[model samples]
Target: MSDSTKQVTEHEVINYLKEHPEFFINNPGLLQQLTIGNPQGDVVSLADRKMLQLQTKNQQLAKQMKQLIANAQRSEGLMDRLFQLLTDLSMNAPKGEFVSALVGFIQKDFASDYFKLYLGDIKLSDDEVCVHYHSAQLKTLFASFNNNDAPLAGRLPAVKLKALFGDESAAQSAIVLPIGAKAAHGLLAFGSKDDQKFHPDHASDVLQKLAQILAVFFDSQAVNDGQQSQS
Candidate 1:
């Protein structure tokens, strides 16, 4: 009848079992002291009692493995499309055709409902695609991004949505990938009518790589234009 010997806490018992996994095997008499209640309400062997815990642990590990595999597969698919996009952009063609092809390839491969490619001063044959903006205006609109070059996804305010899309833009959510404020002074936006299409967690490193490639194209085209003017 002492306070210290009243009872052992559940934490101590669990810790003891974890630290000494062979305790039950070493003392067979201890197994008779442990019992787990099942739906059938009958006693099970110690092995049967531990089976449920082991099965639960296995299921958790399996779930984690499945998630990892899914992520890897998604990344692989993006890389393949990116390679195709790069190959398309590398072909020898007129500047107008090059930009048009770049936009077309992205629209086809990325499954975007609506998209806007904003370049500083480029003129497109299609007036609908002539979504150009000054670098200062872009810096202001995307100031929320903290000047980082990563792609952003999720809902945008009505003003930012209108600025990126159009006045009658029907996009409920979108993904914005910054090309370069200094070099290209451009951005690529993918919009979707479905709010869940570009949910907050849809960030992809592939889009950042795509943005970098676009910056290179813009810089190279600038150089090409300069050469043509001199010749």
Candidate 2:
């Protein structure tokens, strides 16, 4: 036969084997004789290669399952802590006491190096926990915060870090969350001494929820203050 005819016949044999998968089961000796070439220029029995592939896949699946379980446990713990914080805030602490309690919980429970709440034009007697800034100042400082409600986490610029924290601040990383939907109120900033503590890829769902809860507290305080002034 011609070389072309031999090539066509070889291809037809492969196609036929694929179509009749049971053919190998009937001919056990043929399977034992089949060898496949490996990337390392070694030859292994086809059956052995297939078994190795299955073992690798099973190992990968086990690793993935373990990671998923660990993530779920961490998430449950965080949820429990968040619920406790909400309960504590609901006890109707006075304005100064509330600010103190909030800052203490954030610093101790959340392990934040520095935490500050900035309120635009909203006056607070506890200047240590809260800061008052003009609308123009906020716009100028946080120009990159396009989505006001979204949390921003990463290494902050030196100028921005100095503006938020004082000139003496030694924070390496930070997370900033807008307090209100319209961002008319202000922002909540959390700083960390560890540079890798906060990154752009970090998940912010929990932080955003916490910011929303704080917004409710601020709004309630504003309403109460308005009522007291009218009385």
Candidate 3:
């Protein structure tokens, strides 16, 4: 017989084993009888290697499960707060009333050190929380968002902090959510004293959801205002 005919390829063995998964149970002695070589040049019985592989896989799965649990627990409180905020804002509120309610929630439930909101050109005077929408600054800072309702989270330098909040000592870390569809309606910025409070890696689905709703709310109002003006 030729060498090729005599040789039992690994693929054939794998296919055979897969086709008959009960092969191991039927030939139990092969578990100890067969030996495989590892990359470390160690020869271990098939049974030992299988057990080691299973243990490693189990450890990896356990670690993944723990991380999933941690993320879920962290999001639970934020979800509750977001739900409450939505409930409060659903009272056919005017823009000024909406801003007040949101600022209150941010200070109390969201634990933000400082927060600012900028909507379209309105009659209200400029303040820390409600500011005139400087289109140029927003365009510069959030060019990456491409003028969409996306949230930006990370630490900001003194230069950026000074430009946005008019105070270099405004915040160490911050989250900014752009509120708009195509043209920007405005933005909401939350600042924190803690340097590690906000980060790019931190998943903030709740805030993104709120920003989308705010964009829709503002767009609908603008449409209604235009209709009333025409009438």
lDDT of 3 by residue, 1-231 (tens): 998689898999999999999998998987899999999999999989999999999999999899888778867876787677878675356876665666566566555776777666444644534455646777676666674445778887776666666665558888888777543777777778888988988666766776676787777778878998999
The runs of at least 3 residues in candidate 2 whose Cα sits more than 4 Å from the true structure, single-residue gaps closed, are 1-71, 121-139, 144-147, 228-231
Who is ahead in lDDT, 2 or 3? Answer: 2
Model 2 Cα lDDT, one tens digit per residue, 58-86 = 99999989977876786678778878867
Model 1 regions more than 4 Å off = 1-68, 127-139, 144-146, 181-183, 199-201, 229-231
TM-score of each: 0.61, 0.59, 0.59
Q: Can you write out model 1's per-residue Cα lDDT over 1-231, one digit (the tens) per residue?
A: 898788989999899999999987799897767677878898787767888789999999999899879877877887887787677567345656667766666766677778887777566565446456545766688875554656778887878878777788789899888777533457888888888888778856766776777777777777888998999
Worst 10 residues of 3 by lDDT: 121-130
Order of the predicted models by TM-score, top scorer first:
1, 2, 3
**Regions more than 4 Å wrong, model 3:** 1-74, 77-81, 88-92, 125-132, 147-149
- As a whole number from 0 to 100, the lDDT of residue 153 in candidate 1 is 85
